[model samples]
Target: MTQTLTLTWTTVCLLDRLEPDRGVAALVDGVQIALFRTADGLFAIDNRDPVSGAYVLSRGIVGSRDGVPTLASPLHKQVYDLRSGHCLDLPGVAVARHEARCRNGLVEVRLRQEG
Candidate 1:
């Protein structure tokens, strides 16, 4: 059986307002999410840096590693995959990644549910 999941998308800002290769912070349902606009596409992840306990992921440097979009934490410079939120520098550590899309020039974000 296939289960259907409903996602509530929150409109964050205008797509034109976001510059390419940069990140912005938004609060959805009391959770802080970091939204990134890269040449590849839009990506969302938790704003809190797991290494330094700092809510500064939005300020991370945006770049690519081996053709994969990545964000390096501003505090500790730990690179994280924007698509999977996996820490490339650390083993078995990851950040929460969310769904982000552009609809009618608006940037919307959907929080990913964790099991």
Candidate 2:
């Protein structure tokens, strides 16, 4: 596992701006990430495409399989787990999971280094 890097949380957009089944992209320390608001009003995953390194996860589609929320890569259709950063279609592969929360009516993502 890679050492966790402390990512200062930044409010990329307003909660009202993000609708269900849509996403927006933000750069946290040169790392491109996609923030998704699921159909259920919950947020998950960053848009870094591990398979292609395109950093276009935010532009990908959002949906669920077996009731698990998933984000598919825009470049390659690789699906990632929003909660665990696990790649659903690839074994032994994972993406960087950002610690995200809402505070003061704003959504914030803290990119922590994985242990």
Candidate 3:
């Protein structure tokens, strides 16, 4: 069975705090998350590098595979699925995906919590 967790979205920082080609790490209820805003003022990806177990995915290169947004790892070239948190290049590698929404000029990441 699938369990659904409700994660509260909190504004950890401002949008201007994020720079191009880099990401910011934030903690929501003990969960480590990375947020990245693309250079074009669109798109954000969590910075967790599942392959290397490092929070360096934010520092990875941002590119698209046939228009699909993807984040490359800084340590390794492993790419992950930003929306579903799946590893395209590697099988069985998945990252924690959060429900993110932008509202009132603030970006909020919905975290999942256990009841």
lDDT of 2 by residue, 1-115 (tens): 4666676887766677777788788776665777877765455455667788766788888888788888887788888777787989999878877766777778877776656
TM-score each candidate.
0.93, 0.83, 0.80
- Backbone steric clashes in candidate 1, count: 0
Candidate 1 segments whose C-alpha is farther than 4 A from its true place: 1-6
The lDDT-based order of candidates, best leading, equals: 1, 2, 3
lDDT of each: 0.92, 0.75, 0.68
Measured by lDDT, the strongest candidate is 1
Summing lDDT over every window of 10 consecutive residues in candidate 3, give the lowest-scoring window. 38-47
Better of 1 and 3 by TM-score: 1
Q: Tens digits of per-residue lDDT for model 3 on 64-102?
A: 676667777889788876767788899998777676656
When summed lDDT is taken over every stretch of 10 residues in candidate 1, the lowest stretch is 1-10
* Model 2 misplacement above 4 A: 1-5
**Model 1 global lDDT (CA atoms, 0 to 1):** 0.92
Between which residue pairs do clashes occur in model 2? 4-113, 5-113, 34-47
